[model samples]
Target: MPRVVVDVMPKPEILDPQGKAVLGALPRLGFSGVADVRQGKRFELEIEGELTEQVLGEVRQMAETLLSNPVIEDFTVSVETPVAPVPGAGA
Candidate 1:
């Protein structure tokens, strides 16, 4: 089976309160070297077969219509890469 991943995030111009809160807490929590943070959403879709152009188109449509809001958010879609099986883990 194949899979697709959709990543949605607010536009850079938009203010991210949640991300700001986390950023403010980071220094107090003894964390440094991090300048900023932006929150985002990720969606993973399990596909039935090989990832085709048509499927990609449909996924893009889905992102445009339902997965993300075009006004304040931007989204990217990509096919998931398969992981190699571990060697000597099983028969």
Candidate 2:
């Protein structure tokens, strides 16, 4: 099976309150050296068969229409490579 990933983020000019809240909490949580934080969304979609240009195009359309708000958010689509399990790592 093939997989696709979509990443959505607020436009740079837009204010992200959630991101600000996280940034404010980081220092109190004993984490330092982080100057900023921008919250976003990631979606993984599993394909039923071999990945093709049509499927990729459909995924892009999906991202644009349902996954993100084009007015204030930007989204990127990409193919995800599966990570093979390491030999004996679970042992």
Candidate 3:
């Protein structure tokens, strides 16, 4: 099986209250050198069948229509890379 990823983020012009809250808390929590922060969403779709252009297009459409709000946000779609199993994990 292959997995698809969709990342959605607020537009630069939009305000992100969650990201702001985290940014404000970071400094008080002993974190520094971070200038800014923007919050986003990631969606992973594990799908069956071969990875083809049509599948990619459908995923893109899903991102544009349902996964992300095109009005106040922008989205990026990609195929997720699979991780290899640990050499001795099963042992």
Q: What lDDT is reached at residue 73 by model 1?
A: 93
Residue 72 in candidate 1 has what lDDT? 90
Model 3 Cα RMSD, Å? 2.7
Cα RMSD, model 1: 2.9
Q: Kindly list the per-residue Cα lDDT of model 1 for residues 14-56, writing each as its tens digit.
A: 9988889999999999999999999989999998887889999
Off by over 4 Å in 3: 82-91
List the candidates' TM-scores in order. Answer: 0.87, 0.89, 0.88
Top-lDDT structure, candidate number: 2
lDDT of 3 by residue, 1-91 (tens): 7889999999999999989999999989999999999999999999788888999999999999999999999999988766676887872
TM-score: model 3 vs. ground truth: 0.88
Output the worst ten-in-a-row residue range by lDDT, candidate 1. Answer: 82-91
Scored by lDDT, model 1 comes in at 0.91
Question: Candidates' lDDT values, in order?
Answer: 0.91, 0.92, 0.91
Pick the TM-score winner: 2
Instruction: Give me candidate 1's TM-score against the actual structure.
Output: 0.87
User: Candidate 3 — number of clashing residue pairs?
Assistant: 0
Residue 57 CA displacement from its true place in model 3, Å: 0.4
